[model samples]
Target: MPAPDLDLRLVRCFTTVAEHLHLGRAALALHTTQPALSRQISRLERQVGARLLDRSPRGTALTEAGRVFLPRALALLDSAAEAVAGARAVGRDRITVGYGVNLIVTPAVAELRRRHPGADVRARHVEWDRVRSSLLERRVDAVVARLPLDDDGLRVVVLREEPRALLVPTGHRLADRRSVTLDDVADEPMPRVPDERWNAFWRVDPRPGGGPAPDGPLVESAEDKAELVASGQAVAIVPGGEHLRRVRPGLVAVPLEGVEPSRVALATRAGERGPLVAEFRELAATHLVG
Candidate 1:
């Protein structure tokens, strides 16, 4: 028998539903009504020839088939995004560079346009965890990512270095300190990153004199981390960016002493530097350095 034709839209609907686990919440997230979302998922179940989710009186739960298909579904979505980006790349003079909220790439983006004139240079504000994958998946040609990025198979150019700061609740013990050392918060649990590689980076691993960090609740975004700080659950060591300072008033960032500053860089896939990507990266480097 021939394989089923999976619709990307249905897959997206399924994934969003899977993430929320509530039809109304998922519909609200997808900007659609619950009935509309239900129709889409029903269509998806027919296409897959299996019930992916089991709706129960208590709530919705994924069926065994869904547990198996979730990861593959996400991978397929990433592949579809890459395909769309690839199609857009062909016969076009455009490049998309994703950056975190902390690192401001606007100045670099403006300079790239000044240098390239007619070529399209766009910027995307990506979440912290999605930075590296954005580059790898071709969703963006390049990214302005923080330092200690794995250099195994990627090209990275350091743009600038900035001090790291500790974000704590306004009323926390260390909030009034002029500056803090890693030793001061050595015992305080820090927010966690799901990816081990990022877990260390955000946590500022290798404490003073090479100590292990105390673990805290999982955090995946600035807002999430801020909540942890405000709730006195955890603290965050982050790049000292003005944007970070302005996002949450409940949290206060004090400069972290006795540690190296964070490095911001322009990263691209190794040996895959098309002209537009190269030009944008060069402009970013020169502008930031100058």
Candidate 2:
């Protein structure tokens, strides 16, 4: 028998639903209605000939089949995205660079544009957590990333380092201090994020005495983290840069003492040494003064 012809759209819907595990949330993420998302998931389940998710009023859980299929589904989506990017890059002078929050790349981009008058150079704002993956998946040709990232297969050039600071609510005990050490906020709740390395580094986890930082609300974005701090729900350690000084109202950034500074760097896929990318990397190294 011939295999079932799967629709990539349905696969994408399944992956989005699987990611959030809530129809309404997944729909919001995908910019579709809940009923539409539900129908898409049902169509995918029928095509796959197995129920991938077990949904109830309380919550949603992945079925045995889902656990088995999730990785393959992710790989499929990644491959599709990469293929599209590759197709677009051929015979075109285009390069898209992604950057994390509060990091600037315009000087480098301007230089590159001046050097290659016909090249299409674009700058995109990427979320902190997605910086590394954005490059590996070919979502962007390069990225301006904060350091301590998993640079397994990328060429990273450290631009500079910035002192780290602790962000606390204005009325918090440490807010008025000239500078605070890890011990000052050791017992305070910190926002937890999905990236373990990122979470640990920013939280300064596993303190000198070897205990984990107190976990608070889960955050997925810089705004989320800043909001949590402003609301007095959690504290966060962020780069002590002028641009990042006043991220949210009711929050104050006090210089954090006794910790490694944050490194900012330009990163690109190791194998992509094309002229446009190379020139941009060199310009970034020289121009992006942290």
Candidate 3:
């Protein structure tokens, strides 16, 4: 026959009595009557085949067995409390996800809502670097970012890969090319975007020897960068994703010649949490494709 299980109620009853050294006081601590507490302790002692405490004229004192096992009982109580808190952390009325600094409002985000109508899906945009921190601190369960992140313990999935293009002014020499090489644009004027903002673009100094930096104007915001390219005053690098499909005639996109292209990936912490986190991961798998 299998041995009887260790009961939590017995641990609690023992701990209370151990601390108070009196049945009545321990019962009060547990919000139970003294007779009930006594019965619980008796059962615990019988299961262990040892007396936990000795009753004398003055009060109860810990027996040798109780002294030996008190620390383990205390550990059990602490573990129970922690287990409950961990479970509560994953439950929520609605799921909040970090959209990162990029767009998650595409068709896939819409589909997630349709699948989980009862769950409220709200979003907040943050810097790409902050995505992992947000997940670790519980600010958001998951985030969408350009993946292959350097986070020590995070998970990433390739969501989408769009062709990258060089955005040049209409009259620029490279603009006339059916396709242009990164070397052809080496001497062309370029503008700078915030390091944080341009992280998604695969345009990180693709030339050899850091050859002769272009003496170009610096521009903030992709819109201004696009405008600079359109005005023919400067050329900017751009990802030829759906976002760029709306380019006007003043701006022309030509593929980079002889250079390997790059793609974007979605990232999040590993392991399962709430339903929302799972849903977002699934959304990335379906929407983000190479």
Per-model TM-score on C-alpha atoms: 0.72, 0.74, 0.56
* lDDT by residue for model 2 (169-246), tens: 889988889899998887899988887898788888877789998888888988888888888898899998742455
- Give the 10-residue window scoring lowest on summed lDDT in candidate 1: 240-249
Q: TM-score order of candidates, best first? A: 2, 1, 3
Candidate 3 residue lDDT tens string, 1-290: 67656688898899889999999899999999988988899899988778998876698999999998789889978878766644566676455567643455455567778887877676777565576777665556666665435666667766766666788767777667777776777778777645533432335453455554364566645567778778877776666664356667787888765644545666667764566677767776877553
Stretches off by above 4 angstroms in model 2 are 1-82, 242-244
Tens-place lDDT per residue, model 1, 203-229, is 866555677789789877777887888
User: Which model is ahead, 1 or 2, in terms of TM-score?
Assistant: 2
Better of 1 and 3 by TM-score: 1
- The lowest-lDDT stretch of 10 consecutive residues in candidate 2 is 241-250
Best by lDDT: 2
The TM-score measured for candidate 1 stands at 0.72
lDDT of 3: 0.69
Arrange candidates by lDDT, descending: 2, 1, 3
Question: What alpha-carbon RMSD in Å does predicted model 3 have with respect to the real structure?
Answer: 14.8
lDDT of 1 at 151: 65
